[model samples]
Target: MQFVCPQCHISYPATSQRLRCAECGGPLDVADRKRFDPAAINTEDHSLWRYRAMLSLPDGARVVSMGEGMTPLVEAGFAGQPIHFKLEYISPSGSFKDRGTTVLTTALKAWGVTRAADDSSGNAGASFAAYCARAGLAAEVFTPASASPAKLAQIAVFGARLNKVEGAREKATEALEAAAGGGLVYASHAWSPLTLEGTKTIAYEIWEQLGRGVPTCYVCPIGQGSLLLGAYRGFKDLLAAGLIAKLPRIIGVQSIACMPIVEALRQGLDRAAPVEKKLSVAEGISLARPIRDREILRAIRESGGDALAVSDDETLAAQRDLAQIGLYVEPTSAVVGAALKRLKVDGVTVAALTGSGLKSPPALR
Candidate 1:
């Protein structure tokens, strides 16, 4: 397997720590074109590792896992419509990020990396910190100073050095990049292809749980678009294996406060457009510039998907509605619920509840 840039087709060794292509500065993807096979799945392992045959890792690498994956696909009611909510929050790190962190950490250990750095608004940082601790690697996380106290506490408790950078979310990423220059492995969820390798397992689980069929539509909150892109790739794998006829319509939700993807889609742009960043209750998806902007747009367009933005008030209302249904998720996850109300999508649809409400401020919860 090699790290290949989708934009410029530049290839790097699979074990290379470089996050993006030097030629084009685009995010890299694993160039392993291995197809998915249901018979090859390790039925005994319930975690994402069950799809070990499909993952792109060094041969014989030890999987650093905390039993993350196979989140319950619960069919619930939202706005008088029955929808399947993929509860990704019931994870080792209280968010969907554990899926990527597990695989990324395993890859880092395989590559002989002992120290790693990453940045996130909250969930991804906490998740990476926890996984690094499990792998006995020195971990440092850079997060926005305005990040939730609960999430910062989680990162600190895992024994990882936490750097709270003041200002915008991108400032935290800048801090992480500076540390990476000082010899720390950049285990970024947005830039690392291995992270997608882990997140694609979600599509496999959804297929397995849904009687080996694809859903009509899949909705999820998008920041860096890892979850959506990963699911799209997984479904593509299933399609290659002849297990499914077509990919599901993937709907990406963003906050109206910071909706670059939505604006780009509306304008038929090939990349995410620069927009005025505003403070949002859903801090997690408030990314002003996603690294994989072009790839995300392609995924949405190719799958006949759409991107939509919801207001903060609508997101909070959705949060309350989800809580009423016993699904307590962070405001970021609630964006999907708000999008669903707007789409009023019928038939078999899955909404990814990405993070736990416990990770948010107590007042929000």
Candidate 2:
């Protein structure tokens, strides 16, 4: 099993230490691997590693994890429609990226990497720092200078070096890449395929929660597109292995301030054109340039799914709705809840609350 570049057709072995496609310089992933066997489901354990057989990891690899999986699938409603909230903020670092970092960090450690560098809006860096700490790997994170101070502090608290860049969210990637030397592995959540491998567990858990049935639709907020792509790749594996009969239509929500993927879909382009970066309250999903842009758009398109945008006001209001129902989530996660009113479909839906709202900026609350 291996990861193939969407742009270059260059295939890298699943265990390749190199992250980007050697052929076209595009991002890569462990997407094309086989699916799970219901017969092999390890109901005994709870973390994302429960789906170990479904991933491309080596046998008996020491997984660097922080108990990031089995997040609650909360039942909620809006306009009398049934909705399920996949609360991911309950993760160790208070976001879904913990799932990815857990697996990616372990993989880096297995590759003999003692130091790594990457970038994020907030959660990814924190999660990576935590796992890297556990794995005894040095981590350096570059983030937008405008991120939540608390979130930035968490990175340092984890003993990871932090680089605060002056500019937009997109520039964070440039800075991190620039700083990454031959000795430092770029364990970038946006570029690393293994990171999303851990995220695929969300799909498996959703299936288990629904009595082994797929949700009618999954509305998620996309930043680097890890969650969306993970779910998409997970379902694809399941279908290939005859684990599930079909896949859900993936609906992604983006902030109006910087909805690059939405514009890409609307324009029928696989690649998301560049857009001016804006400081949105939902820092986690505020990417103007995603590394997996083409693959992400392909998932949105192939699933017969659509990309939608919601205003900052609407997202904040949904944060209150989540709190009322007893889920403290950040604005990025709340965007999925806010997107429910905007969805045209009428059926059982799952909106992944990407983060816990307690992390929202004080002014918004």
Task: Judging by TM-score against the true structure, name the best candidate.
Answer: 1
Q: How does each model score on TM-score?
A: 0.97, 0.94
lDDT of each: 0.90, 0.81
Best by lDDT: 1
- lDDT string for model 2 (272-313, tens) is 998886767777888777888888898988888998888889
Supply the global lDDT for candidate 1.
Answer: 0.90
Overall local distance difference test of candidate 2:
0.81
TM-score of candidate 1 versus the correct structure, residues matched by position: 0.97
Predicted structure 2: clash tally: 5
Instruction: Itemize residue pairs with steric clashes in candidate 2.
Output: 328-357, 329-356, 329-357, 330-356, 330-357
Q: What does each candidate score in C-alpha RMSD? A: 1.2, 2.0
RMSD of 2: 2.0
